[model samples]
Target chain A: MDWNKILLFSILVMVHVPIVSIGQEKLAMQWENVPEEIVQGRLEPQGTASFQRFPQELQKEVREPVWQLSRNSAGLYIDFESDASDIIVEYDVEDQFSFPHMPATGVSGLDLYAMDENSGWQWVRGIYSFKDTISYRYNGIKPAIKGSLRTFRLYLPLYNTVRSLRIGVAENSIFKPIKTKEQNPIVVYGTSIVQGACASRPGLAWTSILGRYIDKPVVNLGFSGNGKLEPEVIDFILRASPSIIVLDCMPNFRDSQKAEESIIKSIERIRAANDTVPILLIEHAGYSDGFVQNERLEIYENLNKATQRAFTYLKSQGINFLHLVKKEDINLGKESFVDGTHPNDHGMVGYAMAISKALTEKEILD
Target chain B: MDWNKILLFSILVMVHVPIVSIGQEKLAMQWENVPEEIVQGRLEPQGTASFQRFPQELQKEVREPVWQLSRNSAGLYIDFESDASDIIVEYDVEDQFSFPHMPATGVSGLDLYAMDENSGWQWVRGIYSFKDTISYRYNGIKPAIKGSLRTFRLYLPLYNTVRSLRIGVAENSIFKPIKTKEQNPIVVYGTSIVQGACASRPGLAWTSILGRYIDKPVVNLGFSGNGKLEPEVIDFILRASPSIIVLDCMPNFRDSQKAEESIIKSIERIRAANDTVPILLIEHAGYSDGFVQNERLEIYENLNKATQRAFTYLKSQGINFLHLVKKEDINLGKESFVDGTHPNDHGMVGYAMAISKALTEKEILD
Candidate 1:
């Protein structure tokens, strides 16, 4: 309104919300004002549909064969900067489920993380909803870490669609957007686990955890139950020039030969695209309950064997950039699953830790 | 009932439920049929007040000064056995909460485990209620390890009161109670985390995990927000005559000197009663969010210092049976918490692993 009214408003904001620092003027900006380089999830939006994540053609096509792809936001993150002592965010999520077993946080939530000079990237908080009949809004969250200059990263919804998001800081806080560097994004393509099914929050997903652990940006192309090596999806993945590509889609292959055929084809395409970029292949983290269930054990064994055979065949072809991680090394314990299938947070941590350890030991991630 | 009718009913029981091992007469018994030692947690129950966990006096006294204690079922468990292929449980709980942030599973649930010869203790499943105001029924859950005779350990509710319970097994399965040996019952006395707050299920609690890890009977005496080493509670803890006592009560010790005072008194009493029983004193798991919030960091620093001072005093007193575990060794990350205060499953595992490692290193537990 007026200058005096604006001063009164700033005072009111500081007094009412727990998110403001004294003495410094507060600054507010809409999402559109930020530079595009800071946003990382979607392919560059064109024309009037600039805010949409997927390309129009791909979005329309995905709805035909894989409706799950349109809903999954496995590898989307926005990096931002503000010198304010407090940061606030408001976001709306679409298509939230009321599943009795899986909580809303795992279903549709935005995960926040910050990186400092010493610790690299560390998780800060999750903005979630208890119920979402309409769109979900998370408001008045303040996660501004003091003492060090911080680069905050926000992971988008894991299993839901997002309508819009608005982030704010104190009136006088200096702010800027950080675009994802095109140099070498880590690319992880896998089943629902990689897409972050049943993680208590988006940040706890194994892929997200590994990304933070390795201090790099990650592109998640995981489709809930559709990470089977579709040639079309593979074509899309090839567009992202990543330093390393991780494949963990054996669980979705269903049939052993299909798993083998997909694994071979995807590896071949990736090799053709870039002969030197490291490719990491992961076997299925067989159901933990399978230890007691004979039928479940057979399903695990058959799938794992097929992946193993494909790995052996690929190794014989002198593909020096290829690396394989055995499922046993993942060592998911009986306590890891939320349901006997999708992993809980514990399982996600185990999977991330195992993958990180293997990559480090193999000299692929050093 | 007539003899023919009884025979027909037996045949019907065999036909409907998969619990029947066949060829043997079916046997069903109410919880009262089990011996007192086999049904741990509760003291003797007189008259119709059968499902009571603590003695009337303790429950009454707990509510007087420490109301929170009345609601926590931290360390209660039932030790029972049956040869039945499938075991069925029917349990009713009281004071179920509608807090959306925490689920009924963490609030109140029955955690089941079976000890096998090779694997020690393996989790079978948890019986939880998604809604309030009902008794939860777990039916047709078979946990028979093909080669070994299994004895099941059932951890009681974490935050609710159990009104009654029914245990049923296969027609041919022989069931019996295995008492906590007079020589060693792994005893853990701690705060709410040990009291199993926010754990996805009771079995995932650190105390329960350690019990399974060690393959020993355990007595959990965790009191939420009330584990300040009160003399009355200490007296109750001493009754178990355990081989070792683990103290993890830093969270409840909000005041530093008071914490130091309590730890010394408890250790003194335990040493006086049984000089040789090893007592493992644990420092507080400093808040995961403290890495960002200085106010939170100060609370952690103050509490841990108090516990450390108490440990130092105990060691200086020539209490060779005393041992200390630092919270840093626990290594809980930010994602481990559900809220800023309580740990989810991931934090529980880290806590359990750190404590177990310390105990193993000290040779207190082989």
Candidate 2:
């Protein structure tokens, strides 16, 4: 067709359907691309994919399982400000939709939270579809006050790798990316529970909860079934320049001797590199079956005993800023687990509460 | 020739494998069939399938969705007493293993709880597999006392239809089926939240939790999105001879006028037949995003207001044993929901607490 005919057709279409309002008086939607730099919780800004947890250099340094799990955007999130009443999120993931125990909402789905008038984070509900391309549509979002834009943080999938991501809002509404200021992040290096094994949603993960509570960035280096406190992972964690380092890998250890050695080495290596960064060593949040299973109870007791011994030895060597959290402190009740080993949302909240309380008691957050 | 060959093969197998001890010194396992009479929570014994919630006669009376959802073993469970240190459960399901938001553990999984020394039920953990034949193996179970057998209640799947079920224990351990005594049960009729949507496990559902709290059989008549206040379904609930009936289907209604009409009709019908049984009317548990979404908040408020009006009208009519539970009482904080509509494990607990508090306040459970 000629340019004149195309122009005439466009004019006819415009006349047929008004641009400002549709049949229901809804505003026309506009899509915006999100850049990689605005995404928080990664260890490095360079040498990694847009949503990957690890840098490209660590691909060969860490074990296969750790490297593979790092591809999941567990604790990574994007912060932005928007005035749109309706928010739409579209993303593509590279793996299966969900796990047996964990649902798609936690595995491959996105979770959204907006800042309230009091600066507290409130969860935003979205209607999601997980077909070939995942999409989340949040309707009727209101600002904290009239004529004001609201700040929102969108958490990525907890157990799936994303291929692409984009956000859509009503046309003519303001959409601004919020850059995270340069600050030391709280680094958590742990196991499947830390990586959000059985949480119903991404934002319910313990690390994400802690970040919301403290209003700071928390880097999640949690490798499912592979958080062994290896020297390679610790070296990379040190590079993040973390203010508080948490090592919670006792659940991954079956042998007490190996666990003690790894704990001492991980702490000593961190101390050697940085003198005063607070290091918190967390004992295994014992299996929920520990109440009825003597063998599981024995394993938990032995591992916790090893962690206690490691803490005592490290403190004896004049290691400062070292703290330990016992298994009892986690206090995951019998009802908290989805499986006996992994925590559901209730357990996730419990974990965040205990960790935050310990941080407060140690004056680490101060 | 067949008898001789069979005898020779059995002798050889016995010689190769010891009867009393295995490689790990575990006891010889024995399987026991769970009789239909022993399973609790179904409305009637002879009319329904072993694990079905509704009787066969109601198939023609209820809507198609309601009838189909009735096939799901949402609230059915088995009560038994055993002395074995380990327990195994094997069952088969009829439909897909899970949903997009709810996992297989809450759909087709089995949850076991045993009465402790203080008579409080404690969760028992199990390793589960959801293959063609779903199975759960709970190892190293310890009784409350050294020499006494423990009473265990195993919750069935909350969202899938069970085809068959069986329990396995050590060869010499005593396995006794605990028959549910004839008594008035607490009948709950509601929507997906009551049917255990997005729950991490079966035992975490609100009705199951309430049953444990009250130490009585609680019949769950939740029908997912089809939980409209229909007379056909209400008739089945009345047949259970409920000690207290809970109506929590406000979330399933969108129109306030229609909801008010249905509420008034339902209560009047129940009052027509029975007058002494307590009827608790629950307001809508507001959406988690209601704080930010004015549209959702409006819907919740309108529905709740309609419920309040219905309650006042019914009470003015001199309806006896009537109670109302306000939305403020449920108080599902912003973090309680998985998706905004359905309550997660934390929200489920909140729901149970509110309903049980109302029941206690009204002296219905007394």
Candidate 3:
């Protein structure tokens, strides 16, 4: 090698050393910033995490803590004490399990759940009072409670010594506060699954997951097994004046007749409320039960046919507010579900991914 | 009123009345020719409307009549009466309870709830066995002894009489029938939500829903809660030779650092395996909580920023793919969720609709 060539190689090495070192340094910094709990990729032990504990006075009467809960006119009061500069109250409420005939029964109350480092988990009804120290109330329940649990994971920033806390009822404590103003609300209306039954946590639920991802407010109008494309529900949803309306009711219908008529009627009803507001229609996921035996497969075929017909008709009628997700992409097979019906945590992740994929590919979220 | 005009109109009416009545009669006759169920907007129930009771030997262990059971493999021997036709076996492996995590625990298999004109609501499990007669099993344990109830609602076709039923384990009886060779199959891999949860029925999941719409066989590889954008998972997914790979993990990451880095790495890893497979990336839905206070709104902002950066980077690298759903269109807000998180039925519907809209707009789905 020539002397000049050696000099050039040395310069190149000298310049590349800092760049490589910078990359290593950045990686080290990231590792340092990552929380140890998540870094280990295991469920972290619930430690001294600040949480609202139910007061002894009302503890016995409350039900299990759910991921989401709501109640009609009746206020849900939660009480808690924190020295944090900022705190957030979170909860999950909706009907995912119930009788089909009782369409709106699950909308009348709130679901509440709490977890702290000290206590593993606690379930509570919607009301809590703390000796006039603090209270919080949530009003707006027209549906009955469904699903097993609704969780409330409030984020609080501490500034001083914090002891016990209460959730479920209302609270008026002097904690660091962060003010939030509501903005364009997204509204969704559909079938029972949308009500959220088998979800492990409110955050894991696709709707909740979406909310957390977008960092926006959302109002859920998912009736449990009774999402039958009723005009009454549509009217109520319209009155709420949501920026968008999502219609997914084909799953509840036993066959094509109900799916076809209800889907068309739903489109018309929603269009009457807001002509330009976007309306999305989602098809049911295809089941494999029929695939095993050729006989039951027609059900899915008919559903697809009906959905396509409805979409075509809607598009021809100049109803530009529509979208859809097919069944095959949604079902991951038997292993995807804990049972043959509801999905597991892994299933939910798949669902979110599919929806997200569809959205991105179509450029609806841009 | 003109007298002459009235008289002429009456004369014309008198002339047309008989003809109009005759036409009406013909229309009525045509209507009568149509099936009553069709006229009533319900499809006529088809196939044999009876199920063979399990043999006495099988009944020795069954507590209830198995309504609709399936065994995928041939390990458990089933013997049936020679003349028994249209027999359907239904079993409930576990007692029905409104318990939390029941769906996730796999205790509850597929349940078929049917209504009849005489009796109201009836339910049947999807798995059972036949011995000397027909018997049902609840859980892995057989009933302490055997006695069977008659299933009223579920009907089995006589042509499929003497069908073997399969229940527990991955393979065996009725549910997983023999599969025929296929030349093409679609594979989908994504986050946990895609795995399917909270859907009322197996057919309602978006993945399954999509499959039905497209008229294709799909393999689902959705893992719940475990949908971190890991290179290992991506590599595993690529090995399946899927028709398409959808990336939807932004919501799972708490911050942009993980999302951006992992997304890029995942894409690169996937590309390394299959250079030309269609890759679709999905952004997160708007957060319902953000709609309230707009806290963490920057999460999406950062995600989008990173997405755009990645898109440009990929484009420069000669990679071709699509992005689905936009933040503005699919933001999670009050109207979209029942609680601060988790989409009610309405939210799921909305999500499906958005995905469909994005696909249609982008011409990715016909």
Model 3: per-residue Cα lDDT over B87-204, one tens digit each: 2333222223112211212212222222222433222234333223333322221111132222221222111122222222111111211121232334444443344333333333
- Fraction of the true interface contacts (Cα pairs closer than 8 Å across chains) found in each model: 0.12, 0.69, 0.01
Per-residue alpha-carbon lDDT of model 2 for A261-365, expressed as tens digits?
999999999999999999999999988777777788889889999999999999999999999988888888877888889998888988999999999988888
Every prediction's TM-score for the first chain? 0.82, 0.92, 0.54
Name the regions of candidate 3 deviating beyond 4 angstroms.
Answer: A1-366, B1-186, B329-335, B338-341
- Ranked by TM-score, the better of candidates 1 and 2 is 2
C-alpha positional error of residue B346 in candidate 2 after TM-score superposition, expressed in Å = 1.1
lDDT of 3 by residue, A1-366 (tens): 253344233222211111112212321110001111111100111220111111222223333321111111111122232322122222222223222111111222223323333432232222212122322233221111232222233321100111222222112222221222234455556444454433433444455444444544444444445567776556656755666566666666668977888889888888877887666677776543343223345676787789888888888988875777777656554333433344444455566667656655655552
Model 3 chain B: lowest-lDDT 10 consecutive positions: B34-43
- Evaluated at residue B116, the lDDT of candidate 1 is 63
Clashing pairs in 2: none
Comparing 1 and 2 on DockQ, the stronger one: 2
Which predicted model would earn the best DockQ? 2
Provide the clashing-pair count of each candidate structure: 11, 0, 189
Rank order (by DockQ, best first): 2, 1, 3
Candidate 2 ranges with C-alpha deviation above 4 Å: A1-28, B1-28
* TM-score, candidate number 1: 0.81
lDDT of 1 at B105: 56
Model 1 achieves a DockQ score of 0.23
